[model samples]
Target: MKRRFLVAFLLLFFSYSLNIYAVEEEPSPPPNIGFSLNLLGPIFGIYSLGVSSFLTSRVQLGLNGTYFDTRSVDPKVTGWQTQVRMNYFFSPLYKSGFYIGIFGGFESVQIKNNSGRSDNYTDPIGGIIPGYRWSMTKKLDMLLGVMIGYMYGDIQISPELSFVYLL
Candidate 1:
């Protein structure tokens, strides 16, 4: 009798376990706004934040802020910068493959000169930014770019690298 009962219980458990009740749902696509962080800058004590939003398949708007310390540069300088950007993508292979952008912003920097004097300047800045963006995964992306800007009353070039998460 005990053997018979155990066999019956096992059969019933297996029958119920094999039945399907609910189906799993698929994940939704990524959102339009992507928030990013600069990994390269932090190694030298500059912290940066960036955001990009898709206006259309070919157009995107972006903004970036950098708060920097002297650890990054020779002769030791400290400053902050803010930029506003807009990009137009050209490559058809991927909507974000390559982009040309224009950016305008302001930056202030202070440096201590060898004469035991600290000099600071605030400059109006504008730049042409060209970049390439590639999807690392469906929801992740990487952007590599360069900016040529007028800052401190002079022309300057800066490199950019960012990891982004699509919202």
Candidate 2:
């Protein structure tokens, strides 16, 4: 399944390259709020959602929500998180090309322990994310990113994928 997804993504990714060399016009990217998803978290049973807004060709700001609930795994667990993200794309236009960004927020997590005690906390979060953004059409924009940051004061890594409609 992962291979299929990667193949599909690459196909879509390359579909746009054919236009990079064609005649170019005005750069019109998303300037409004964009709804997105964190595709990498689900592999670990984490589900996340996010939203963002672009200020120009080089700046963007957004927020995300993440949740985890498992009953079939060894220990039952439940949790949620919220994060704020800001990014800068080095492209020559708004909402297109490679990017580097930062994020800070908080998370509320809970895990069922063998001692019958649930561990939980709401703590500050921070990270540095590097990614790419692009469009295959006028109405749809996509993002592929990886986040390496701190959560609960611990270093961690996260991969992400998002699709946002231009407004």
Candidate 3:
């Protein structure tokens, strides 16, 4: 009798479990593009702007331009750079999370010596960047990272901070 009761209870439990239902949620669409401005650059006499687009849900393509000048210091330096970068995000969404990227670009710099003579040079630059991005609001976000790269035949590490406005 106990064996018969156990089999009946098991069958009833399986039938009830199979009738249970679950609801699935739909995901929001990924962001298409974003524009970025470097806030820290202005504090150090550099101005920069960038635009980025989503190539897929987890990949992005970006272009940036930057300019800087130091007129008050001896051996004053002035320069500009244009870069192209591709980022692969770790999270499912491309707009926010941790990402690793590679960037390559061309840069030009002019140095003015104490003798008031200016010399200009240009070079190709490339780097690897790893960063974290967080959303501030529905349409605003911030990125913080470091770029380690070769520029002007020297290995340089630069801090990266920017605000992105999504559209």
Which candidate wins on lDDT? 3
lDDT of each: 0.70, 0.69, 0.75
Candidate 1 regions with alpha-carbon error over 4 angstroms: 1-30, 92-96, 113-117
Residue 144 CA displacement from its true place in model 1, Å: 1.2
Candidate 1 lDDT over residue span 117-144, tens digit each = 6778798789876667786876687777
What lDDT tens digits, residue by residue, belong to model 3 across residues 85-141? 897665445234566678999989887889988877699999987677776776787
Preferred candidate (TM-score higher): 2 or 3: 3
**Better-scoring candidate (lDDT), 1 or 3:** 3
How many pairs of residues collide in each model?
Answer: 0, 0, 0
Instruction: Tell me the deviation in Å of residue 18 in model 3.
Output: 31
The superposed Cα distance between candidate 2 and the true structure at residue 104, in angstroms, equals 0.3
Q: Give the 10-residue window scoring lowest on summed lDDT in candidate 1.
A: 21-30
Worst 10 residues of 3 by lDDT: 18-27
Output the lDDT of residue 44, model 1: 80
